[model samples]
Target: MAQTKNLEVWLRGPLPDMPPLLQPIAHALLQAREEVQSFMQDFPEELIWERPAGVASVGYHLQHLAGILDRLFTYARGEALTDEQLASLYAEGKPVEAADQVSALMQQYEQRVDRALEQLRQTDENTLTETRRVGRAQVESTVHGLLFHAAEHTMRHVGQLLVTARILREKTQA
Candidate 1:
């Protein structure tokens, strides 16, 4: 008797052959968030308003992080967008519009992160391993990769934002 192999595995072949419970991506974000929460608290309102010379201000960087996190969630759902789609939505490479209000942006950022975490928790093992088509950059990515990418991306931006904030502070104090 011929048996049909599971398409789930076939589609998710590029997915890591491991259980997601063991995945550290979520933990990494939690840790990064904890660290950044403290740093974000120290960001000066004055600095948030002033554009850094030849660079984005603290608010712009923070908003950018929020925007990217939202994009990652969009990709994880097997529904990626084209760059054009992003532009139409006003999220195109632009810093978050609510950069001045740190509390608002942080609240929204926390919600988005929580949503991604919840989605990660609900993902079935099979789905996590499947290869999903992303907009133009069709990398053989798994749900796990999408989750990790979100975390890593956040960390990268946090580092950049922190430096910008520090520079802003130094310039002002000088």
Candidate 2:
């Protein structure tokens, strides 16, 4: 109990000053990537190689996230992708029955995460104020809005990947 209290005190310290809009989005992106990479590291080779039925396997989720980031990047540049393009992006490097693997998926996802983080870091107050007119989305978004949404999207998928990893681990250990 004493140790726990001391640990809590250490953890609950002051943080450095950061712009309000940039701070949360940056932190969230970093956390999401850490979680995804940590979970992926635990996945066994056999499990990563197998295409689980009726659901996205680890590889699928990683590649899907990479594609989403690319689309978000495109959107940030004021271009909109069609539904077919979005679908193709998600399906671009999927397990090809006899040839695909998880290494490629991890590589793609890591690259996307790095690129998105770079973009997030570059956002400024002016950039945040720049408005973007997305196609029929009922809400116009700014660069900051898109950055935050991208972080949220990555977080959502990271949660799923964590669950998938846990399930695989449990199955293997059982």
Candidate 3:
């Protein structure tokens, strides 16, 4: 996430050590991270949990960005959600005093992205076709499907976060 360049990540070139088939997933995650960083550069602390139109709060999106990655990555590893992970999931939207602040959430988010990228780098393309289970229902998906969904879901949430932040800032300024 410390990448400093004018070009988008994908255009910047292939990520080192990342498998060829997983390159786009890495790019998408990186791009989503950058967008979150940019949009949240000056996001106000007081507005972190504001749900302007009764939709999801910015805080929820931030917590979700990190939590979803952790959950999906855990599934990709052929594992179930640990106690701590399940606890984190339950605490997503409801604020906990100062801990839900923007900086802390962003830090968690950056760390998750870093961990996700590293996992992608270590992912063997040959294993992509192998089936994996998701959530308690144990729904089936391939490694590639799960990872690709992670990227897709990341981008989707980022879009929501960006718009929510923009609306909050604009309304507050006016």
Top model by lDDT, which number? 3
Q: Give candidate 1 regions above 4 Å deviation.
A: 1-23, 82-100, 136-140
Instruction: Write out the backbone clash pairs for model 1.
Output: 12-129, 12-130
Q: Rate the local accuracy (lDDT) of all candidates.
A: 0.66, 0.67, 0.93
C-alpha TM-score for every candidate = 0.72, 0.73, 0.94
| Top-TM-score candidate index | 3
State each candidate's clash count: 2, 0, 0
* RMSD (Å) per prediction: 11.3, 5.1, 2.9
Model 1 vs. true fold: TM: 0.72
> Could you tell me which 10 consecutive residues in candidate 2 have the lowest summed lDDT?
6-15
Q: Give per-residue CA lDDT, model 1, range 1-174, as digits (tens).
A: 334242322232332433455246565555556656777785666556566777766666666676677777677778877675477346423444554676766676677667766766667777666676655767767766776788888888888877877788788789
In model 3, which range of ten residues has the least summed lDDT? 94-103
Q: How well is each residue in 34-109 modelled by candidate 3, as lDDT tens digits?
A: 9999988978889998999898999999999999999999999999999999999999998756654888899999
Q: 1-174 in candidate 2: lDDT tens per residue?
A: 245433322243322444556666656656676667767774676786344455567766777778777777667767788787577675753564434456667777788877876766565667776877665583588776677677788878878777777787788999
Candidate 2: stretches off by over 4 Å: 1-20, 49-53, 82-93, 96-100, 135-139
